[model samples]
Target: MREAEEFVDITLLFGEGHVKCHKVIFMILAGRSDYFHRMFLTSMVESALNEVPIEEISASTGVLLVDYLYTGRIKLTTRNAQDLLVASEMLLLGALKQNIEEFLCEQIESSNCISLLNFARM
Candidate 1:
């Protein structure tokens, strides 16, 4: 079989900054799909989701992710999950995007919240 076409001008987020590259196309592990040509962006997103590990997933992130993946929107309730903030930051999930650094900093400032602090550390 002939090799699949590689991507160019690929830009992926690296923390708060973005990384520009021309050789990361193959790094995107797209799965079996017949709609590739029609839904290129969706295909890539699914591939990216697959790259995330469940072990790294937080308590209610699955729920948040489900909502976003299905509706393109989500409202995070503090009751939904707290530890999820870290996972959200790591996954770049919108549930805990804004002021995450501040929250993480606050958690780290106190030693009693060591578990939460540890969670954010990862």
Candidate 2:
């Protein structure tokens, strides 16, 4: 489905990037994420829009999210783990959030512990 991009009904827009996906897929993902549940299942303004601006998530993160929604898999790296954690938190994706948390935990070192904590507090 990711490759096909067929029957796409909505566009998630980042600053200079966008991802096209089917509302049906989002409807299915709603069960896993309350953020998606509310947006797709409720009478929210975004539910009716063809293009939804997502200012909080980066374009690369959005693409990874869509990939996960379709494939049930993701690759976590220090470069993307923190951003993924923030996105997962906002999306109410507990499992994904936990996965990112675990990955970040494994990456923590004495030198970066304080900085990581500060970023988390922010």
Candidate 3:
């Protein structure tokens, strides 16, 4: 369904249920920043997952993204980049891995052997 239809369905699904369910969901819609943030992050993650539908990604990469989404901080480095590729590769998350692979491949073509090598090794 389209976004508008999905939202309407959700509204109806909740509103047609227990009063408390409607109340709680309404409160979420009205005032929960955390809820919104979590949903926003989930949408981004899902889009990435769709780009490469794989079993899973590296635990470290998932943790890293989750941390960033929730806390807005990550100790990003030249290396976390490579690690993402490795994790994506292992998880067989094709769409997710494809994006990372594309980036690493470009780096390799440009002589960034370290990152490319790490990705290849993974």
Candidate 4:
């Protein structure tokens, strides 16, 4: 297991909700996503404060996104895959986005194709 304080230098606040992640690594985060890279490398407020507010995503999705940055893996299910896909796109995680897109495509059927298509278009 990894030590929280040893590697963690940033915190992500999810909306006005109760989720706050304090175990994010700058290198892994910035390396995996251009959004994170720019946020940390530039003179953005997030770079100075080492914190970011993500209002458009749910707390659960935010946790999954951070976990992917650290572990290179994420638990994607029908229940949360759409939210994860959106988060992955916002984070600029192309590989993860592709994986989720493939997963959704595989799950398509007459029963859910319309809903899935709407999600894909978003």
Clashes (backbone N, CA, C under 3 Å), per candidate, total 0, 0, 5, 0
lDDT of 3 by residue, 5-105 (tens): 33222222111221111223323332323433343345555322212222344445655543333343555456676666565344343544566666656
Clashing pairs in 2: none
Q: Candidate 2 residues 1-122, lDDT tens each?
A: 64687788888897579999888887678877899889878999988899989888999999999788778899998888888898999889999998888888898999989989998898
How do the predictions measure up, each by TM-score?
A: 0.34, 0.91, 0.34, 0.86
Q: Which regions of candidate 2 are displaced past 4 Å?
A: none
- Candidate 2 overall lDDT versus native: 0.87
Q: Which candidate is the best by lDDT?
A: 2
| Residues 1-122 of candidate 1: C-alpha lDDT, one tens digit per residue | 01221343443333333333333332321122122222345545534432322445542565454334334565555443464555555455553455454554554545547766555566
lDDT of 4 by residue, 1-122 (tens): 33344454556887655333443476677888998899888888787775678888887888778778778989889999998888888889999999999998888889999998777676
Root-mean-square deviation of Cα positions for candidate 3 versus the true structure, in angstroms? 14.2
True-structure RMSD for candidate 1: 13.5
Identify the runs in model 1 with alpha carbons over 4 angstroms from their true place.
Answer: 1-52, 94-96, 99-122
| Model 4 misplacement above 4 A | 1-9, 17-24
Global fold similarity of model 4 (TM-score): 0.86
Q: lDDT, candidate 4, residue 41? A: 80
lDDT of 4: 0.78
